[model samples]
Target: MILIINCGSSSLKYQLYTPDLAQVVASGMIAKIGEPEGYIDHFVGHRGEHHRCPVPNHRAAFALMMEYLQSPEYHVIECPRAITAIGHRAVHGGSVFFGSVLVDDAVMKALHECASYAPLHNPCNIIGIEEAQRMFPGTPNVVVFDTAFHQTIPARAHMYALPYELTQEHGIRRYGFHGTSCRYVSQRAADLLNRPIESLSMVVCHLGNGVTMDAVKGGQSIDTSIGFGTFGGVPMGTRAGDFDPAIIFHLVKDRGMSLEEVEEICYKKSGLLGLSGLSNDMREVSEAAAKGNARCQLAVDVFVYHIRKTIGAYAAAMGGLDALVFTAGIGENSAEIRAKVCEGLGFLGVEIDPRANEIARKGHPNISAISARAATLVVPTDEEKMIAIDTVQLTMAQPGAASVQMGHAPSTHGVAAS
Candidate 1:
């Protein structure tokens, strides 16, 4: 079996798959760690069980996960030895890891050094790996980085216009995120179209809470919306994306506001929340807009405008667009937003069937109109399956490794739309 672990600051989400990645054996989550009361929700097949307890930390959570997987009540696995390999979702690998890697002493050292890049996430990921090493001894652990797929971006796109010496000294350059999602969605789009990924020039819009627009050309990322930081992409739930830096200087220097306060406003008090003066969720904003709320309408318009603008820019960058992929929360579910984004892209030969768009989540994911030149697809991303695939491939390359049959595409059994 291959186990995939994704650790947040106070929670862990895990999935277990057979070595071949054809089926998901089990999946669950441990939430509210380090709190007085924590929750564990585990599932085997269609049945689920929930528990409430005082889970002190991630270590305790992992122990409970093991118990649930091996106990007579739910014997998803016989023992720790049943797991052939482990895969972890690491948020930021900085510039050190260009792709998924098998864990080792040197890799651990580098992971620690890169912790400065994502102080809120990488440390938790490191802890998860360390605990897995102690609990599942001798089992190879593979790390699939969220930023790895964008490492193919060239220097011209990744570099900032700042001073060469300053940027080089500080390692300040664009490292686009949501790479794992883009990689999966891009490949899945090709599969759905029955075409080779190498012949496709596509733009993948990952419009979740944290948004990223990736320009994938010939199976490699040429450029992306996100820059040196996560908040530099399209405006997200609470992030103020692509804002003027001069505003920051004016706030701190002229308005006498502290840098910390300005930073908080930029990261936590902006985006849909700031623009709509309501909920950060797109569903709620759309509802309010439908009810004739001016601010909410403005928020929706701004969001759609940015998405459409980015698509046009990427099409120009790639010479022409062959496919436009929509994945993640808002991208997959919101038909209105999809229509609005494609409304102005007629020049690019982009068109969508309204009936197909409405039924996208009902198993008809391709919404492109018959007259359109570019294909538009709503491909649900499977990051965990991607991680599991990487784990199986890396572990199977080892000497004396057991051979396992592999599947051609990722299974969508346990994955939800978001």
Candidate 2:
């Protein structure tokens, strides 16, 4: 068994997969963490069980999940060590660790060093690493970075036109996020197009609570919208996204605001929520907009406008666009946003079949019109599976590697056999 874990600030999502990563034996999510009554939804096959219990912290949550997994009803594994490895999703690798790496004290130190870059995410990720190591001692664990895939971005595109020594000395450069998702979906798009990945030029819009767009050429990320941090892309649920550098100065000098206060506003109180003076959720914003809320409608327009403009820019950057893909939360579910974004993009030969887009929220392969020049698709990103695959491959490459065998270890092959 290979268990994949993705940890957010207050949530943990997990799935147990067969050694080959072919079948998901069990899956569950722990949400609303640190609450008095956190919720858990567990699944096996088509059956599910929901429970609301006190999960004050990630440690408690992981313990409860372990208890459930070890119980008879959910004992898909005969023993703990039968599970070969635990693959964790580490958010920011920066320049220190380019790709997925096996977890160790040194690796953990590196993650801590890079924590300053992703303050909102890396701490929680590190928590998952600590708890998983404590719970599954000696079990090989891997860190699949969200920034690793974007390392392919060339210097000319990634560098700012600022002082040469500043960026070099401070390590200040465009290190893109959502690289993992970009990698999975772009390749998936290539597969769907029935073309070689290196031959496809595509743009991927990862719209979610955090939004990012990538210009992927030859199966590698050449340019991406979000840079240096998650707040560099399109206006997301809470983030203000790519704003003018002068705004901070204006706020500080003229508006009598501190830099910290400005940061707080741009990162948390802006974007859809700040613009609409309403909820950050698109569903709610769309509803309010439909009911003639001008601010909410404006918020929607702003969101759509940025995406449309970016698609044009990135398509130009990649020379020409062959495929356009949407993934992540809002991308996978929002038909209205997708349609609105493609409105003025018809000049780029983009066309959407209204009915196809409406029914394609669950990662449907094609939402473009039959006669459209370029392909439009929604590929639900499988970062967990990617994590699992990398874990299996990297661990197997280590010399003298062995699975931690339990007393009741089955004869069946583990993830390494894959």
TM-score per candidate: 0.94, 0.92
Question: Against the correct fold, how does model 1 do in TM-score?
Answer: 0.94
Residues 1-418 of candidate 1 have per-residue lDDT tens digits of: 8999998889989999987788998999999999998999999899998999988999998998899889897778999999889999998877677778888887888889889988888999999999999999999998888888887777667777788654456667788899999999999999999999999999999998789999999999989998877788788888989988999999999999999999898888888988999978999999999999999999999999999999999999899999999999999999999999999788988999999999999899899999999999999989999999889888878663321221111110111100
lDDT tens string, model 2, 1-418? 9989988898999999999989999889999899777999888889898999888999987887787677698767777787799999988876676678888777888789889989989999999989989888899888888987877777777777778665555656778888888888898889998999999889999998888899999998888888787777799888998988898999999999999999889889998999999988999999999999999999999999999999999999888889989999888888998899889777777899999999995446699998788888988888888888888887888563322211112111121111
Error of 1 at 211 (Å): 0.2
Please identify model 1 stretches exceeding 4 Å from their true place.
Answer: 398-418
- Error (Å) of candidate 1 at residue 328 is 0.5
Residue 64's lDDT within candidate 2 is 76
